[model samples]
Target: MPKLITGGVAVVLCAVIVVHLGLGAAGVGVLDVLSFVAGNGDENTRNVLWGSRIPRTLAGLVVGIALGVSGALIQGATRNPLAAPDTLGVNAGAYFAVAALAFAGVNAGVFGNGGVAFLGGLAAVALVYLLTVGGVLTPGRVLLAGATVSLIGMAGAEFLQILDEHQTRGLFFWGNGSLMQTGLDRPLVVGAVVLAGAALAPLLARSLDLLSLGDETAQAMGVQVNRVRPMALSLAVVLAAAAVTVAGPIGFVGLIAPVAVRLLGIHGHSLLIPLAGLTAATLVLAADAAAQVALPPSAGYGELPVGIVTALIGGPIFIVLARRVITGDADRGAAVVVAQARKSRFVTALVIGCGLLAVAAVVGLRVGDMDISWSDLASVVTGSGQEMANAVVSFRLPRILVAAGAGACLAIAGVAVQSVVRNPLAEPGLMGITGGASAAAMLVILVIPSAPVAVLPVAATAGGVLAMVIIVLIARQLDPTRVVLIGLGMAATTMALVNVMVVGAQMNITAALTWLAGSTYARDLSTLGWLLLPAVVAVMLIVGGRAVNMLALGDDLPRSLGLALGRTRMLVLCGGALLAAGTAAAVGTVGFVGLVAPHLARRIVGTATHRLMPMAAVLGAVLVVVADTVGRSVLAPTEIPVGIVTALLGTPYLVWLLRAK
Candidate 1:
């Protein structure tokens, strides 16, 4: 059976390779490929085959193999079925390192780039390992830590991309995993490293197989469990880094390939390793071939990256698998629990936080290109200020209000989602609500160019709700980790489609990009009005806070306590989605404010949703207002996006949260 399966995969991979090499903008047929190899083809055919098609096909093949083997090794070492480069933060870390190098003008060779990527991936996974409670790795902890790290790394890369868009065009395309190559140079170099990694991988198969028998058992059997696991992981990182260097962090081939191979009943590392590689190569080849036709370069749409196609396909597959992931043991209770505090103290904190937020707002208004003093600001309110002050205040107040309102909405959304999911780490932005809003809004902008600004918030909210519904429906067991993974997949799908839209739009996408980055620059009073929906949603969530509290008490308990688990979850999630959608519409896709504020409020006031919600709203408002202020002031004329600023600020908090006892 194993032999038959391996043979089947190999045959499919070879067929895909041939087809991928033949079909492209140049339209080389199989006959042309054979003829070119026989030295009897036309020069155009030869040029297409040699210059572009062959190299690209080889790149896909090599990267696929590398990613597959890496995924298998990591899964083996971790004893977690969901382990993969992307989910482990390896891909993001590697990509960030390469992007940083490029941004800093390092301009290294292929080997140097691979080395840097390896270091970055290694460091990231090290952090993940260290944060595992008592050094006992669990699937949930690894995934949670990975998601957090990936967010930080991707946010940093986005910041750099935003800082210098023109200089980073090549880097941006590469970051998206373009397989369009002019020559065989990169393919040859990267292919060699991948092949070397693949060769070394089999030697670790015995050690990995033993380690999978659990650390104590393996140790008793005379396996150096600690050394073997680290070595296996190191090799996996090397493989992933090589693939990333060549293909720019293409995702999910590693995940799906190994998982598929395992499901075929081939568990022996010797057979599994090779079969996984063959399967992944087939997937990559097929995705690349489809991409050419999906958005043909010949059609003037430019070739879509193979990575985007793989992500779109892989996302649904991941969601399906997530539905089946065992939920019983994956649960990790709330990360932080604090003693209940006095209501007076909570009230004092809320007042202080709100007051600080107001002061931040005033400070924000007072600064900018043209500064405004307190007296001048007061005069503006009374219609007695200088013309410039009035003009500046008018311009600043709308953006400030939008930021504050969006932040508050998002924070409340976070509180509601975290409670409903019973996961302290839950955030609407991370769970794809914001991404859904952005994608829907982009579609409205592109497809219905006449869409009024007012239509966006409504459209965005609808999209967010739709995405949340899909994610929940896909989740068979409402496991927080599974839901989070499904959400990540949804976000990837929307973002990939959004990327395709941006590429095909053929117009200035500056506004769309700014919004996607969660910026408030040039936002107007109409934006403030969009906050009304979220504000209403916030009120609803606060009113329903008792249900949220009940939800945190596990599934059966809530139902036993006369709380309708399904109905309560649905209501809270809807409210969360509405809030997130409104915020996304108003300020693009600001992240982490929702995540950080709720956690902070929780630590301060305990887990009573009522107290936590209001305090979180205040903190959330303050966070965004301060973030916007810092964003504008940091880069001077070239403003950093508030989304990016929040990410930078929130990442440290996330790390501390992860490490918290």
Candidate 2:
């Protein structure tokens, strides 16, 4: 059965590749490609097949195998099925290295860039591993550390991109996970890495099998757990680096391939590892093929990057899998209950202090562009300052409202997701919800420029919901922490898609830049109306619900309390989806607010309870407003988007929270 499944997959993959080779922006067919390969074809067919198709196919195959093997190695070493190359910060490191090189006007040869990328990948893995290491390596700690590194790396990359537009344009296509073959060296380098990984991997298979039995058991079984682990991780890093060198961090194949193999009942190290490699190769090839043929002819003026296609497909699959894991079929008793603990007096004071900070945020808003005083503010609100009223009502008021609403919604969504997924780091931004929304919005805008403004929000909402559904389903077979890891995979894929769109379509990249930085104030009455209704509905549904309260206890106890697990879970997910999508549609993918607000709320309330949902919402709104206000005023007449400010502020707080815990 397993052989049949693998064989079937192989056949499909081959057919897909053939189709890809035959089809292009210029029309061709299988017969033409075959004739070209045999050197008996027309000039046009020969040029198309040999120059474009063959190289692209080879690049995809090589990169795919590299990523697949890397993912398998990481999962094996960590004993976490969700582990992948990106989990160790390899992608971020490679991206940053390339960005730096490009910014410096250093046009390295393909091999030279590959070498640098490999070194960067290795360095990132080493740093993350060193930071998280104790006597034993914990997958959870590694994931958190990697996330921190990725954030820092991304911020640096963005700064560089802003500083140099020429470099930005050059790196953009590569960043989107392009499989456009530069030369034969790409495949040769990737192939060498895969071969190396294959040779070294079997040496650790016995150790890996023991490691999967848990650290204590592995040690008891005479495995040198620590010694073997570093070696395994090193191998994974090398493989991932090689892949990134060629394909620029095409994500999720590493994640999807091994898991797919496991699902096919190929769990043994010997069988599963090879199967994962093949599956990964096939997936990338198929995606590349689809990018060539499936897209509209007009869409691919230049070659469409394969990464985007994979991300669009992979993100939904990951989300469904996540949801399934969280809502287990067998009721494991009532969701594990968090005690309804009240805040102490000191904590209460802190809450009041934060509230005061929020008031100051309102004042901060008036300090930008044409400054307005408290007197002017009062007059505008009371309709005394007619001229100021024009500015305040039309400009400042809408900006503030959008910022506040978006922040609150995102924060609440983050908190709900983190609680359900049982991970401190889980947020819509981190989990691919933002990416999914962004991609859908980009696609809508690109394909239908004349579409109504309302269509963008609708598209974003649909994409977010689709992603959520896939994640929820995938989570069924794994622990909540694993769900977060899978979500990261999805997030990377979605980001790749966005990059592809930005590069491939050559759209107004300034718009993408603005949205990515999390600017507020795009909201008009129309946007407000669309967002407000959903936000209100979500708040109403979750605010006083017993089921939501029980959910904080964890999944096991809710069932014991007579809550229908599936139904309750679905409701909560739907509510979260609405909250995230509405906020993204309104404010263009704000960051850090969702992550920061709930953590602060939990600090104030001293527990996670659905009753505190209102408080969290309010706090989220306040935090976002303050961040946006700061963003506007920090540079006076010029404005940095609210998203940048929140990320800068929120990331430190997240680190502190994690460290404290």
Candidate 3:
């Protein structure tokens, strides 16, 4: 059966490659390609074949093979079906390394990027491995750790892109994994490396088979488990790096390829390796062909990235995998695992936290290139400040308010979400609310450029509500793992749709990028005014905190206590959506604040929902205020986005929390 399936996949792959090579804007047929190859066609046919279509086809093939084989190695070594280069941060690491080189004023060619990408992938996977070493290396733990590292890598890359928008246009196109090659040089170079890596991979086939028997058994059987593990992983990284160099970090090919082969019941590394390569190649070719025809190169909408197409397809597949029986501790333990504080103590902590937020806001006002002293700050309030200081304060205050308000809103949103889901990891980003708001906001920006500023927040809010409804409906069982995975699928779908809009509309992506990165760079008081609704929602949430607290007792207990469980959940969910929407409207989906702030507040103030709600809001405010301040002052004229700053700050704490016993 496996052999038959593999043979079928091979035939389909060939058919796809052939069809793709002949179809394009030029309308060249298979016969034309054959004639050009046979030296009997005209110059136009020759130019189309040899110059564009042939090189593109070859690049996709090489990329597919590389990603598939690498994914197989990662999953086999990790003994985790969810393991893939993209999921494990290897692809993001590679893309960031290349983007960093470009951002640093280096035009390092394809080879340079490949080398750096290899190192970056190695480093990222090493961190993930280290995080899991003391544990039993469960699939859930490894996947979450990979997700954390991926977030950090992506944030770093986005920071670099924000630094030099003009010089990085090529990087952006490449970052999205476009396969618009003009010549064969890149494919040839990357293909040589991929072939070399593939040839070397089978040497560890015997050891890999043994390792799958578990590390202790493999070690007892005279396999140098440590050495063999690293060797296999290194080979995988090398292949992924080569693929990224050729196709700009195309995601999910590595993931889907191996998973697809495994579903066909292939397990031996010797067989799985080659079959996975063929499967991935076929998937990539099919995706590229679909992308070409869906928008059509002749339609003038520009070619959609094959990466987007693959993501749109792979997300549902991932959701299915997540829902199936798998190995790991999927149960997220304890809603709040911290020492309980007294009412007075909770008040003290909330006061202290709010005080810190205020201090951070003041520092933000005074700490830019032109610093404003306390006297200047007072004088500005009194209308007697120096003109320069007054100007600086005027420029800074609105963004500071927006940051604080958005942070508080997000933190409160997290608290509300975690209450109902009973999972500490539940946040707006994980629920697809952020992605939905982003997609809707981008649509408004591109489709109605003449619309008033007020329209964005309303559109964003409506989108958030829509996404929340979808997540709620689909996650009827409300299993934390299933809900999160469903949300991930929805998020990926929305992001893919957004990418299509960006490429199709040829919109000015600068503002969109800033919003996506969650920047407060040029936000004004009007944006702050829009945050009032979220603030009001936060207050309502806090007032109803006791009902939320009942959720911790599990479903039956809440019902027994006379709480309208369904109605309360519905109301809280709506409140959560409103908070996220308001913040997205104000500052563009600032990530991690919602995830991190609530946890920190729980640690400091205990699990009483009423106390947790306000404490989390204060902490959230402090976090975004500090993040905004650091983002603006760290690089002076070149600002880092606040969203990136939050991710960099929060991911380590999240990793540690996951690693904790």
Candidate 4:
């Protein structure tokens, strides 16, 4: 009964906000809109009502309800409150599909674009699901897989945007999330799709309730877990795709709406589902109103993308919720502790792994643009070849060192973050440290182009630290997984910020492309020196204490061990910030070295203690240097960014890991 009342209030609020907002060139009041609607008003007012305000309102309504319900379904299915259209790559898929079509000169009107977006969204969801395929769907695996796909999709989108300026403008505006009308057909189609999805959603409510009890329990209850899971997912994808097609991928509404409903203590889907829809409606209406009024007029005449505005508000709220989860205030069952047991066989193999890294370093110098034989390498090292000595010393040697150092530093940061957070997936890149650093560095370059090159590292470090601090503070009260969710949120914000910057800069596209792709061997000696200093400092910090061990036991265990949890967390975070920032500042944002290295290390040396820290660091260096070498040699004159290469390699490995475990 209370749920119904709350929903009623939400609906009223949504209606008020929607009706009060003026539309188009001649703004009309609520009474004027109503008078025009009732067939008792001026032709201009009637045209304005039918042509602009009504379509805009309907778009908001349909899109809001779609995102809200879709969010709830995704969150329930994945058992992750952070799961939503944006987080799961549904919006990305839709946006990219439309953008591609636009660039291809496919004048797919709104309805045609909707169809394309729907297919694309379905494909993306299917890919994410397949990547994390296992006996049971785990939240962690789903999130990781979704994240990987989102990154790949976003990268593709950015690349396409660079290739076509007109499409880029269209996507940029669309990506911001708007309720502006292209035509009335869009709202009608979206409305029909949303209604169909809503009807199907209730049918899954029982299964969702059972599923929330987990796969084992649901199976025991004869829930046909497999079939039910896919059905729910299909419904969610349809809703999300429809929403994106109409409103251009508004973010966080779905994530925030269901969470809001859940927090309101409406657990039963019969009640929570409708209320969540209402909450979503209210949120979008409110956000749209704000976007119309609050932003500077010179920014954009139409409206700030409602999606970006939602992110600005919803990101912080999500972070707060995540912190609550991390602190064990929300869900105690979510906290995880890594066991402290070592295996001799794994340790032995890890030593062998280090030897392989040494070989990789040697090979890295020999496989670049100018391939030098081992004899040439030896001659150069021994100062025997005075002829090619300068070439070897100035170019090949520095490149090798850059690759090795960056790989090692990133790997160590990944391992340290995982240890500190007690989550195997807690890498710097995954957690937005690299993205933050990259964004900050880009800002520094844009605003103060004449600043010393050395300042890039400093700016990156500050950005990394700032990002880490935001995540930590927000997740301080949540569980490790929740902290990971907050990191994902930060990653989204950072990526969006980067996109905006790249679009607005009008800089050389090649430079932007190189940076986004994660090049590592572009720096001279001064940058190299800056990178090396931080790499050394990070290594020292990682090797310094038993804090790593205590941290793996989760927050409580560390406190019980008489460790100063706050100080230790700060120290580890600082080390990681320095490492990621310096590396990002030196090279571009290298991909999955940080993520893949620690997992690879754990597989070889076992997760016991920080005993494997050094091994992981060395292995990370090998992975990166080898990837860099492959990136350089594979295309000859045209070098692929090492980051892109790593993604290609690491994404598969991650999927394999998910399936194996």
Among the numbered candidates, top lDDT falls to 1
lDDT head-to-head 1 vs 3, winner: 1
- For all predictions, the C-alpha RMSD in Å is 2.3, 5.4, 2.9, 5.6
Error of 4 at 527 (Å): 2.0
lDDT of each: 0.83, 0.70, 0.82, 0.74
lDDT of 4 by residue, 1-661 (tens): 6747785756686565546445445657667766765768788777777777778878888988899889888887777776888878888888778777877888977678888988878888987877766534545456656776776666556556544544445665676688888568889977998988887787888888888898899999989988987887788888888888888888889889999888767887766676777788888888777666655334444346678678777767766655544233133322222333345576577678778877887777777667777777788878786576457556766677778788888888887777677666677887888888988999999899999877888899899889988888776553556667789778767866765566456555456766766886565555568687667866686566477667656667779878998888778877887788778888878867877887777766676545567777788888888888887887676677788777778767655654553
Error of 4 at 587 (Å): 3.4
Model 3 CA lDDT for position 424 = 72
TM-score of 4: 0.76
Query: How much is the lDDT of residue 182 in candidate 1?
Result: 70
* Residue pair clashes in candidate 1: none
lDDT of 4: 0.74
Encode model 2's per-residue lDDT on 1-661: one tens digit a residue. 8779778877877776777687666677887876766878898887777677777788877788788877888889877654677656787777778777767878886667777877777777876665564422444455666776677556656656544554455455566578877566667766776777876777777888888898899999999988998888878877777787787767668878999988888787776777788789889887877776655455645656776777676665655544433322123321212233457554464477568656855675467767777777777767777685457556776677767667768877876666556555667877767777877888898899999988888898888777777677766543555566566657766676776677667665555766776777555555577677558755665564666667656556778888786776666666676678767777876776667776666666654455345566777777878877776776666566677667777767655544442
lDDT of 1 by residue, 1-661 (tens): 8879988988888778878878876777877877776889998997788888888898888889999999999989888877888888898999999889878989798989999999989987887776675633557667778878888778888888878767545655677787777778888998888888888888878877887888898888888987888898999999999888888988888899989988899888988887888898899889888877777777887657778788888877777766666644335544332224434479888889989998999999998766778899999988899999988988889999988888899999998887777666778877888888888887888899997778888889988888888888887456766677778778888787777777667444454556677899988888788999899889988887888898877777888889888988898898999999888988888999888998888777878888999999999999999999998977777788899899999988887777766
lDDT of 2: 0.70
Of 1 and 4, which scores higher on lDDT?
1
| Candidate topping TM-score | 1
Q: Tens-digit lDDT track for model 3 on 513-606? A: 7767788988888888889888999999999889989877777788988999988988898899889977988898688888888888877878
| Lowest lDDT block of 10, candidate 3 | 329-338
Q: Name the regions of candidate 1 deviating beyond 4 angstroms.
A: 133-136, 327-344, 370-382, 507-511
Better of 3 and 4 by lDDT: 3
